[model samples]
Target: MSTADNNSQYDKFPEVAIAGRYHEAWQGWPQVVAALQEALAAQPRQKTVLVVECYHGVAQQELLKALILPLRPAALFDAADARRSTAEIEALIAGDLTDDPVFGRRSSLPLAAFFDPAKCAQMQQAIAAVSHGLVVVAGTGAALMADGDLLVYADLARWEIQQRFRRGELGNYGADNARADLLSRYKRAFFIDWRVLDRHKVPLLQRADFLLDTHQAGSPRLVSGAALHAGLRQVARQPFRVVPFFDPGVWGGQWMKHQFDLDPAAANYAWCFDCVPEENSLLMRFGDVRVEIPALDLVLLYPQPLLGDAAYARFGAEFPIRFDLLDTVGGQNLSLQVHPTLPYIRQQFGMAYTQDESYYLLAAEPDAGVCLGVKTGTRPDEMMAALAQAAQGEGRFDDARFINRFPARRHDHFLIPAGTVHCAGAGSVVLEISATPYLFTFKLWDWGRLGLDGRPRPLHLHHGGNVIDWQRDTDWVTRELVNRVEPVAAGPGWQEERTGLHPSQFIETRRHWFSVPVLHHTDGRVNVLNLIEGEEAVVESPSGSFAPFVVHFAETFIIPAAVGAYRIRPCGRSLGQRLGTLKAWVREEETPC
Candidate 1:
């Protein structure tokens, strides 16, 4: 949380303009340029073109003005010239029927048009014409990675982009749309860039002579070759914590406010995006200064090393899982919704994966419940009628009549596979663990409520109706979605239980309780663990492969598959209570190693 200066080696991270306030992004680029200069000297003399690829909204031109021009390269080629005009890009996307405002447009279409080979080749020829002097190609693309060229990548997290966009640094599409529409477009752009970066991340890191972490405010560092490899391995093999960001919602609750010691002045804390890499920051400590970057870098830099061989084989470079909190305590129910099925997601959003989530009840109050599936005998037409009524603001969509409400208690695990409509009811705090595709939730109803911004939240009734499996009625859901708890084994002061719900799922989840250090090994699969009922625990490897990692109650930490044998020992508080932890990993059957 304290991102400025950990050691004081560098000046304080500068706060950039953000939503009527200031937010920190990567430190100045001066140091980065200096380090890069040294690295560049070792590169072959024939490497005349220096391509600096960057993510969107990174102000690549500004970076050049501040750092690169001082070096005085002979010719500078701005890649922005090659990009299709905004009108052209929008026109191409408009042709696709799947480009839904609520579900989001496809990223591939516009990207394909943006990276046309003819445009890239034309830009490359212009750079080549600039004879013996240094030619700098600054912006996105790898159209010119010759044998002697130097490629540097500039990366910023999606969260930073959001902050800048809100402050108007990133172009607001136009003044024609309202704030909500602009914000929606901004979010849509984030997903597009995410897919683009994820696709080329590994190759860029492999090819680039240097990597610039531009996520933090004032401390920028260049990493390459062995240093880059070793540093990434260190992060992947150790217990890593990303900076968690909180947001308020219309149905926000106070549970996270008290538990996490968050801002009390705010209305309430609804979501704590603790470990979702796409929207979170990874803080790396370098001596007295701290450098921050998007957590997605880990998955991009070393997919097999971080996600394990099996997971990589199945999910490719995508981080197949996610962990976040949804608090309803002293608030109201989440919108009744269903995530798109795998095929539907791929066809509609051009995404390779879909969201299949499960709610692990962290805390529950009296009469707390979860809205799951539809009532036993509800017809498809009946379900649509109710949603239509709510969308018209005629009345609150009644969950009791159409949706199955199950009483929720602490530690209750409710599986919500794609196609199963679900929501967390009032008076409960839920830890949502699911597949990493998080933005595709199709809300059929929102209880006639408005958003925190005072606008009616966009509803995806059309998409939700198409995705919901009507056969997943009350009886089928009650029998299948409710997880079964079966004791697996017990040792001195320790016990393990298999708590998974579906056999077809990719992740195998289990609960562990221990009074002493529990010995465990990754065995070629990454593990995500949560301290369900413990004050704290120290995760250590006897071989000193990684620094000892500490996790507090309600905190989720990752254990990379590369971390072989390790032990988790209960620390300071709650010595009387058995420390409880829930761990999930790729199933052994799927993991050949």
Candidate 2:
């Protein structure tokens, strides 16, 4: 490139150098200073170099001394800094330095004003006017102009240099790496939970099970039931049992033993309650996702046909399968349960069921266990016999039938198909992705336990029995669990295979750790960007509109369809290094008749 081109690039804050203990600081600072000094010394009389400092600091002091003092003919300070306001800094640089009080204060400068680099515009234009003489140095002066040009000085630290780097100011630095690292650490720090959830204060749990029990009447009435049936009689006709499970005793026997921490008998860990009725079943609504099943205390994320009718109409039409990130804190050895397949549900209950799901294990303690498919050679009769014995409180069914068992480990993903008997082990936080609205869990065994209310937890033996496919193809279950495809390539976009039975209903998601600018093509499909790892990225539209997108851990963003091409740019000093991004595209599939 010619000198003019080079000068233009450098003038626009083409490079940022962060000068600290790290060697990377030399990237943007010293180079720009040297270039400016060379140009100024060569054409001194004709061109006036204006160095504006916003305020006084160590870095600013050093910068002025090194670059301006060597060839200084004039000096200026921001008149605004002094209690005396004067003419604008612009007019003074135009050989009008003595026109007003602005010109007098411009002579005594500090370094702090430049702390905010955005204010360097006016100073740059004023200096450019001096064609060859009187290099004016002012505190709190503009170093950059509107036309994308910049002025540089020495004695600035690496952090300031890096800031200018993002504005297209610095050069020759591994800015992408620094930016990525900085962004990553910020995200990690921001997402760590510092406070634990107190059960008494949890709003959703309180709303689900508030009861008005009368000692005189002998039974309690769930307040939620009254709210549902008050005026919307037709809509709220379904009955529900809103039972809360905040006690440790109930969870210890049912699901806690398999988790990391042994149930603290004194501490109430499991705060969920079942919203079931004494006589009839009711629809349970939590947030957006709702289910029309027997009222059960289950943790849900984004609910299917999202919470309200309006939200359902808006999002359900485009994104149907809702998912939640479930964190099962204590070990849970749930009663052996089986979900009915679509065919079985349709044939037996005249209902459609799609229970295919996968678990992305996030955390697990030693001895963390999960019960997968039934034993390879075990038949329906053997399972039934074992279940009968267990129901009668006879033998330990877990060890007798040789049911498929495995220790849960972090990052391990297990795919559970409908009718494949399975249970979530204790001490695990799993990201459960499924294609079912119904949580139809048929309990085959529950370790003979009762709730705090002195009632034995009812088991759905018949429903569970009818759904267990005795002659299930074991190979299909194993294959789905073992097979997983990498979603993102090292370069761009994602590569995912059609592995699951309903692969068409699932989207291909790619995880990305981007540093430099990446332009992605959306191809007319709606995309969801979920930030599982990091924060702050600039999603710039093809039309040049850009917004700062912040992603805390587990936060999600739904990018509208027809978004076209977009570029992601990291923010702050850790622009490229610590920044992480995930891209997801909705999979198109024909609705089942």
How do all models score by TM-score?
A: 0.87, 0.43
- Taking all chains together, the TM-score of candidate 1 against the true structure is 0.87
Q: Model 1, 446-490: lDDT tens per residue?
A: 888888767888898888899998888989988888867889999
lDDT of 2 by residue, 1-593 (tens): 22431121111111111112221111123433444455456553554544332211123344445434654556443312322112232232223122221111112122222123333444445545654455554432222221111232111222233343344433221112323433222222111100011111122322321211111111112222233222122222111112212235355332222222323344434422211111112333322212222111111112221122332333342233333344445535556677767676566433433556665555567877677776668777777777878777786666435466777886566666677777776666554555433334567777676655476555666667777766543465455554454443455422222333235234445546566666666555544453333344556665653333333333334443434566666655446554554455545444589
For model 2 the local lDDT of residue 258 reads 25
Q: Each model's number of backbone clashes? A: 8, 80
Most lDDT-accurate candidate: 1
> In model 1, where is the ten-residue run with the lowest total lDDT?
9-18
What local distance difference test score does each model get?
0.73, 0.40
